[model samples]
Target: MRNLQGWEIFVLLAVVVLLFGAKRLPDTARGLGRSLRIFKAETKGLREDDAKDATKDTTVTTAAAEPVVVEPRPIESGVAQAPAAGAHAVHRDAADR
Candidate 1:
């Protein structure tokens, strides 16, 4: 719980300048700023996407809670019913081949 004094700030800046020369400091700061901005934007987008997905899930759950009624199809006697579209059917009769 200690606040940095002016001397500490000056010393930290001096060390940073020594580590990465004065010429490269501006470029480094700019790159750091850009990286932080990009990270913030990506995190914001992810939060928004999560919020949208949560809403969609809630809506889907509410809709699913309602009962659905399905009508039964009539079948004809003595007739082989064709399978529905996109369904695989196996023929049991060898004579029909």
Candidate 2:
């Protein structure tokens, strides 16, 4: 078991070569190569998918900034503050046009 002579290895090779002929060896190698390529491509695709999922779209908000609030005034207050309120009638041209 420790030391294997050259003749022993030659005998093993001869037996394997006979069991699987030389003509069929190339086909088997090609099939093995194609399988490995497909496996690598699938692994790469899964890695890209994982990366896309890792960098997501939802915004990340820190609690440091204070929120800004906007308030809407009543309709009567807006009409009273308007400069042209007395000069122009409300919705007068809209009905004529």
lDDT per residue for candidate 1 within 2-67, as digits (tens), equals: 999999999999999999999999999999999999999999999999998877745333222333
Q: Model 1 off-target regions past 4 Å?
A: 57-97
| Candidate no. 1 TM-score | 0.58
Worst 10 residues of 1 by lDDT: 59-68
Model 1: lDDT equals 0.78
Query: In model 2, which regions exceed 4 Å deviation?
Result: 1-13, 58-97
- In candidate 2 the C-alpha lDDT for residue 3 amounts to 86
Question: In candidate 1, which residue pairs get closer than 3 Å at backbone N, Cα or C atoms, i.e. clash?
Answer: none
lDDT of 1 at 91: 39
Per-candidate TM-scores read 0.58, 0.45
Across 1-97, the per-residue lDDT of candidate 2 in tens digits comes to 4888999999987887898898887898899999999999999999999999889876877554433444444558445564433443334343353
Best by lDDT: 1
Cα error, residue 18 of model 1, in Å, equals: 0.7
**What's model 1's lDDT at 41?**
100
Backbone Cα, N, C clashes tallied per candidate: 0, 0
